[model samples]
Target: MKKVALLVIVTFSVITTYGSIKSYNNLNISSGTMIAILIMIISLSIFLTLIIDRKTLKKRYIEKENELKHLNTELEETNIELESSYKKIEKLNSSILKILELSSFFSAPKLMERDFEKKVLDLALEIIEPAENGAIYLFDENNNAKMVFAKGYDYEKINELNLKKNDLIIPEKAEIIKDIHKINKNKMSPKKFAAFIKLGGNLKETLITPISFNNELFGIITLDIENNSPLKNYEDYHTKIMDYFGKTFAGFLKMLNFIKQEGKFHKDIALTLVKTLEYYDNYTRGHSERVANWASLIAEKMNLDKRKIEQIYWAGILHDIGKIFVPQSILNKAGKLSPEEFEKIKLHPTKGEELLKKVDGMEEISKIIRHHHERYDGKGYPDGLRGKNIPIESRILAVVDSFDAMISERPYKRSLTKDEAIYQLKRMTMKQFDGEVVRTFIDIIDNFNIK
Candidate 1:
């Protein structure tokens, strides 16, 4: 820009000097007019140079403004990305915390516990509108939305007040349609026996998010506010976010339930195996039931924890599974077994353990079966350890097993009287049964229903 200005100035100066000399020496025009003409030409050159400089200045100003605007746009975009990333980190941290909470109830949350639905609904409330009211409804086979979990305001409270679990006509705002996220609660909607949830008010804002997995609708969740609620508006983005999370949670629920279903399926298989015992020997079948039931009563009477009681119950039922491996001839033998046959009968416990160890989640049950025959005084077999060396469940099982065998009729003799069976158990307590377990068994047997 400076170089162009300088060149114009030098050329105009040279022309003015030459024109002055011409008028003074040889030209016909007056020196004054020639001077005016030279001045005018110089003025015109100065004006044109000023114009070019102004154009260059204007161009630079416009270019600078454009560059600043571009930078501003980039900054805005970067801010958006940073905000998005921060939210993702926060959400991930929250999910990890929730998973940790779930781990307390389930070793691995393969099935969704009831609290999971509430947690998800809480998140939905936070994302869209944090109302105190919310609920999760699962679709039954008939496609009716059945309320499984309820929050601030739901059918549960009605039943808590001695009302029906649900009103005959549920409020429109409380109901949810399958496969859509929507909200249309208003003053015009009618009210009903409204579960005493909101103190007393009408629906303010309601949002329902459908939980879908693999393009199939699983359930819906609804959150609403009472009249005079805080929020006045809802946004589309909130629905999108709720829908996305709803879908994610639904998939987790489905996957976990599958694990539960599989576990139940395994239990059915175990029971079927038990049924095979009945086919071969009704005495053993009936004996197994009585023992299982009586063992559960003893465990409960002993004030054992829930898990221990459950262990004893399942262990008692499956204890005789090893007997399946014993030859049917020996299992149903009408007379006392020969020594060789007795040894073969003793093998049943080990056989049961070996077969059942292959089943998932039944390791403890198998071990209990293996040790159920172990005597409290260390005379038991398969792996005889001393008193208190046997698994507690097995010790409990020994007393229950003996009591049931005595009270139940066998092919060899008529069953003992209940009182007589009690006397035998008490007589054998220290040597054949764990003393404490026997006492607990005695204490609870009368309360137990045998039939």
Candidate 2:
């Protein structure tokens, strides 16, 4: 509008100047009139230049505004991508932590075969989501499916179903069974398949995977979602995770079997030493076994872990192993031992430790054996370890070993009755034995006949 108005004013001024020049020529106009006309023209030219400059500045401002909007959009997109990446990193960290937790499960000590299988099933369930039920099945020599571990269902009922390897229509890889009844009856046993359908009303989706390594199937792990429709609840990664767990568990089982075989051999060697002690002194017959049984019972009553209880039991078996070095005359002596003979008896704990430390994996057992005679008040020999300084396994053994010896007949002394043995145990608390261990030992005596 300003440019158009300036153009109009300039046009009118030009026409007016033309008319004024004519008048000046005809009438001989004054010099002031010419100067006034020149001033008007100069003023219009200045106004037009200012308007053009303002238009250029306005255009630049609009361009700059558009550039800023584009930059803001790009920044917003980058923020979204960054937020997504951060979430992925957090999820990856969680998965890694779960994997580390699962990796450490097998290393835990003293789990029986069934306990180990149950642990595997539990850890698998933890990693996968929305799974309320799981079971682990092993293939027996007859190619029969034996339910070793079951969760979220009637365990006894499932085990009684008598599932066979040939009865299953599973592929080599892990799979999600969306509908159990949809499976072709011609490919699977109708009798067993119908049994699963009738066994649990809540069984909906089943993720069945083989526990295999090198294409050799050792077992099967099955996870279930209860009381839900057969929707696409699992992804490809779920099956992959199941497969990984199956293979890992298979490897663990193989290693466990090998370890069990090795453990049997080591046990046989330990038993041989026990038999040697028995042959040396007829009075000590069955003494070591009885002590082991009592120590294990006391350990169980104390709520010790499986690993520690096993160690205590082995320590009990080998507690008298060092006494093999003692002279037969000193062992069966009906009379009281001389001071020199007593010193020889005290050396047995140290001797037991020295002998067993040479064997692999017996390091912990040796430590327990070496300190079993150490009294709570430091009055006992072999280390004089006082108060809580003794290993817990040794403290447990101290109570059990003394009680068994008190109740068992020996050449040097008559066996005390059960009540008398219990009295002696209570009397010696905090002095000759750990009070907690003594109490734990006596509390469990009613479960077994001491003699």
Candidate 3:
């Protein structure tokens, strides 16, 4: 504005002087008109300059606004990326927690009440979303995949289509099918493909995962999703999770087998010890085996669980193991044991317990053996554990043991008739034996042949 104003003043001064000179010379134009024209030109020039400056300021402001908007867009995109990453992290954490829960569940012994394979499948279906149904195909003795457990599918139809190793298109770890109908014809055997399609007519997607450990395949797990499934996309994580579960189940089975073999090995050792005891005591040659059988039968009649019955059977076998420590002279004596000899005889239960407790997993059996002589009224043992204080297995052992002793011919006593033995058991019930156990035993043996 300053430069423009200065230039306008100089131009107007020159024009006014020229107009004055011309007017003086020829009297054609007046100096006053020239001055008025110069003023209008100056005013117009100032207005245009202001408009131009305003336009420049507006353009710069718009540029700055656009830069801010671009920055905000980038920040929003970054925030979205961060949010996605956080969600992924949360998902991973959830998966890890679920895996830990599975590890804990599979770690414990559920050998009695639960069908482990089916239970595992049920739990898997719960965590692995989009899976409407599943089946576990374990390899049978012939190395053929057999459907051991199934859910939400016709098990009989699937089982009829036995999946041989060569009939499968499953990857070593896992594979997913986007659409079951679109699966390549050559990927699986035609017979298997047709059977699968027939059995799973509504199935849209399938995830085939192998149960394996140390690269050795044990079985295959197949999970299905229907056409109307909630989640249509089978994510990478889903396959990973199923693969993890398959491997974990395989590991659990391996551990369970190891435990069973270990248990059998221990039982073998215990039976060997029983044989030694039987050899040392001729009067009780077949006593241990008979007691064990009768105890198991009584336990079964009482509806005890398989585990408890097995423990009772083993306890029966090992109950008299400590008699090996007793002097043969005292055992073969023709009369009743003297007080000192009786006291020594009473130590057998404790001695047997002490010996067996040293072995792993035999603590409960040792306890049963220790308290087998305990009376129902609390007056029949080294520990004198009374009634309910005694272990139920020990109480059962007492009934079977006393009845056998009454009927067996010993050095100083004649064998009682079956009727006499039943009377003795009845007379001793509630005093020396559990009334329920005694009743169960009598009922079982009434028609049972011991031979």
Candidate 4:
């Protein structure tokens, strides 16, 4: 409207300039007023255009600011979600690590023997934090419970614990709480409370978790509520962790028992073979055991690999297993043996290899036994493999075997003193044994003071 008005004013002024200039000059009107009116109309039109432009720019600026704010809000929400997801993933990773660490106890075939119950209790307490003390009770085939271990809590800890069948609270299913005051004194007695009483504390409520297998409860782990217990502010997340323990331990214990049974079977068989030697010659009683111990010391002194050490140890224990095949008369012979008798005795190493080779998983063990009697100079027996050609395990066994034989009293000769035995070992380093192995054995005997 202002532009149109300015146009109209300009048009009027132009017409007046031409039509009224001469008449105004006649009527006394000045040309300056016409120019001044044109300037006012143009200034008003320019000011109105500036006002419209400012409003449009301000509206666009506000719209852009609102859009930026919206984008920022969305980014903030996304950041919050990402942080939450990261925390969840972090927790999941931590849980997985804990499970794997616990599973390692099961993975090791040997570690689960002496400290099995203690390890289980420790892992359980870690998962179920602030626990005071606990006992792990394993049931026998007769469904009888025995407390195998107890640990944690200064006040409630037991240095030595033994739970009879009547003292345990084994359940037919998984459970979480046990009331000691309500338990039958004659059946599920709190016999373990006596140990804590000595520490000026008594038992209260117990959190019990039964380890079940094949629908039968085989074991129970119990955490206590004692004076020093810190389990007051327990959270809801502990349920899943404790449940995992019960189930995992149950499965692991079953497998662990199988390993133990297998190990015990091997020992029982080895002992049976040793007894045969003992029966034939009383001097051979515990000879294999001593040889094994000495071989282990030598292996450690040399810093042998763990697997190699285990192999050497077993080889030394069963080195003379073939003596059973030799005649009793030959083993017990006191005087110088006839050529036939010596030949029969030499067959022991071969007989041992044959006997053990038939068994499963004894391949390396049999090989070590076959070579234990071999000499470093390639003159020993069976294979006559020389120098480093002999297995490292066999070289280790030969040194300890000779050392043990020298120190041991035989029917044919007087036992050499430990010093005399050492001198003989040093004298025959290259001929009878590996020089490095013999040196390591000397260090073992000197450092460990085997006497």
Candidate 5:
């Protein structure tokens, strides 16, 4: 539009100037007057066109330049967003891998505090990379944070500091101190502020994440990075990460508690069952306890692991639970039992196994109870598993069970001395008993002088 207007103005001026010059020459005007009038009209028209064109060009260039600048700014922002998203994805992947590793570690049947703390510290460092120092302060049973593990601190310096429970700062307190320093608040005492600053020690960047289980505060994990490179606008992100970690740790702690509780429950149940059986039979009152004690000793002598020892003890207590099915007449018969009655009595081991198999975590103990009567030479009844085929626990039970039976008075027979029982066990070695188990049992008795 501007170009068209300028073209029209120039054409009109050129025609007017030509007409004026011709009239002046025709009317006999002086040559000087004609020349001056033509020059003035031409110069005035050229000046007006130049002014319009310059203003139009300058306005167009300014508008175009502003559009380009806006586009460049938008492109720069998009690139920044893309870069931020990439970093987040990378952090997410790293977090996932760390969680998997932590899960595997915590899944073990047993977890020691020292080993667990090491794993926690390793994961903390991975999440807060480039940190100069790290510490895991676990809340003790009393709900107080105590530094359980630390990395990148001088042992001598730590000991010299002697930072007791009171001196150690809590998570809330640490956050307050950090907030105060961030805003440069001077209301706090200088001495106290200095001590707080010294605790963190030139590390302006610090992260404190709480470790909690079932809404119970378990501990806190803190990481420190270099001064002046502190994370910006990280409260929300840090909270989310900490919450995830806390929930995971809480799950592991719950599982551990459950395992411990289950173990105690099993022990308590075994003790109660033993007591019930003892109440039913006068001759066997306290008999299960003595057998369990002896069986555990024998197991230890044979170098069995602690879990196996526990199983052996529990099985010993319940080994005779099947005797409940036997008639009192037969069980307490003062005279020798007929062949039929003796055969009926021999079924107790199978009955005991069947009865105990219903209980969870008692399957192994049931198997031991079932095979307790089996002879090492395959002469015993109820499946006659011989020698090593018999579970070691059952073999140990057999030795202890027989020893307790001999030492306890019964309706059919009087009690034997410890020496006599030991002698009888030696005689039955390799036949009614595993020779190794019998040997260990005898050694246990001799060592403990239980007679």
Candidate 6:
């Protein structure tokens, strides 16, 4: 920019000098030497102006370049900071997925506080990294929240505090906190919840985040740090980071609620289906529920995961769904079944599997239902999957199904005693059923005092 300015100024100076010399020569004056000196003076003046303009332009260009460089440096720093923040968010997202997976355990009819606390705290700590103290409080039906788990705190003293339901008592000052309750009541803008922390008789900062699910506040996750600084202090992007964490936690809780509702819905539908099947066939009255209970017990004895146990329970409840398609005469026949009638009965497992496969998310349970009739020696119907090729769940279901059949009253035979049922199971081990699964079944029956 400076070089262009200098060139323009030099060209103008040369043109002006030439014009002045030409005018002096055309005047033909006696004072030729004076006119020549006058031209020299004019040329010098133009040269000085050009030099001054060049200096000014150089100064401006240097200032502009320096300003642009500073801006580029700041932009680069910002981009790096944004990239780091994004990576942190991604890590937080992965942690939330783990929390969701853990929360699936609570989808059962009963929520075990011990298990819930252990899993919740583990995930919470990972999300809120660098926190020295934390606690997870659960909301009870009476609208009160109680601490179920605490880390890095004196349990006895904290328990003595007895934080009430929706109660916001600051431990250090005994001042009743107010924002949390207002937020719960108002449903307006976000409210900040804070408390004073006391460490060695000195006041510090304490913060609590309220956990909410489905528009109902569950409990607070409390944190205490050493200094009196605001919770929003320490990290420059603390507000944004905390907000992201809170939203993620909320999403996880929502997903947990959804899963729980889904599981219950499925259970209800399965039970209803069992009841319907019972209504249709007197011989199989109460058979589905019994099978479900036995299957669940067998699954537990086999040390199956909660998900598998749940699948087994549902499969047991709906195992006879295919019986709905069978004719009433054949199902209630009082004599030995003809080969054709028996073949029809054998199709129930496959029919049930086909019906359940239409519903989404029931693939595992449906597969178990379909394969429950399979023999360990690869002689079963639908699919003759040999040992180990069958799903372990299906194997467990096979034991429970046969046991229920033996012990339940039928048209052609009477029910067996509990001991007789166990004896029969032991008699068929390996040849007709998985041996280890049968043992597990026996153990469960013994331990639970099942009659």
| Pairs of residues at least 3 apart in sequence or in different chains that clash in candidate 5 | none
Give the residue spans of candidate 3 off by over 4 A: 1-91, 112-114, 179-189, 200-203, 228-231, 271-306, 327-334, 358-360, 375-390, 407-451
| Candidate 3's TM-score | 0.70
My TM-score estimates for the predictions, one after another, are 0.62, 0.74, 0.70, 0.60, 0.60, 0.62
Q: Which ten residues in a row have the lowest lDDT in candidate 3?
A: 105-114
All predictions: root-mean-square deviation over Cα? 8.7, 5.4, 7.0, 7.7, 9.5, 9.1
Q: Show model 1 residue runs off by greater than 4 Å.
A: 1-95, 103-129, 156-210, 213-216, 225-227, 231-252, 302-311, 386-389, 449-451
Candidate 1 Cα deviation (angstroms), residue 26:
59
As a whole number from 0 to 100, the lDDT of residue 247 in candidate 5 is: 67
Worst 10 residues of 1 by lDDT: 179-188
True lDDT of residue 151, candidate 6: 74
Q: What is candidate 5's lDDT per residue for 110-198, written digit by digit as tens?
A: 35344677777778677755556777766566544456677865433443443433344445322312432443225335654465455
Work out how many backbone clashes candidate 6 has. 1
lDDT of 5 at 276: 70
lDDT of each: 0.70, 0.80, 0.80, 0.73, 0.73, 0.68
Badly placed stretches (over 4 Å) of model 5 are 1-209, 212-217, 222-246
What residue runs in model 2 are displaced by over 4 Å at the alpha carbon?
1-89, 113-119, 130-133, 150-155, 169-186, 198-208, 213-216, 224-232, 418-428, 442-451
Query: Model 2, 1-451: lDDT tens per residue?
Result: 6666777777788778867787768677767887787677867677776878689789988999899999999999999999977765665566557766666777736345447777777777877776778888888779888778788667678678887776654558889886555663454577766777676555667788888877778888888887564553765667767777777778777777777887888799999998888999776788788789989988888888888889889999999888888898898898889999989988889999999999877899999999999999999878789999999899988887888788887766899999999999999999898888888877788987655
lDDT of 4 by residue, 291-404 (tens): 898888778778886666777778888899888898887788778799988888889888999998887657789999988889989999888999999998889888888887
Q: In candidate 1, what are the lDDT values of residues 1-451, reduced to their tens digit?
A: 5747676676868686766678677556777977787777777777777877898889999999999999999999999999987876666566555534544534333233446666666656665544557777776556555566777654554334432222222332223332121122221123323334343246665666767678766676766665565555444444555555666666766766677787689779878988988887667767777788888878887788666777678788788888878889888887888999999989988998998889887888899999999998889988887798898889988888888888777787788887898889888888888999987877776686653
| Model 5 RMSD, rounded to 1 decimal | 9.5
Against the true structure, candidate 2 reaches a TM-score of 0.74
- When sorted by TM-score, best at the front, the candidate numbers are 2, 3, 6, 1, 4, 5
Report the C-alpha lDDT of model 6 over 265-349, residue by residue, as the tens digit. Answer: 8778777887788888886787777778878887876678777787888888887899999998888888999999998998898
Cα distance off (Å), candidate 2, residue 439: 3.8
Worst 10 contiguous positions by lDDT, candidate 6: 192-201
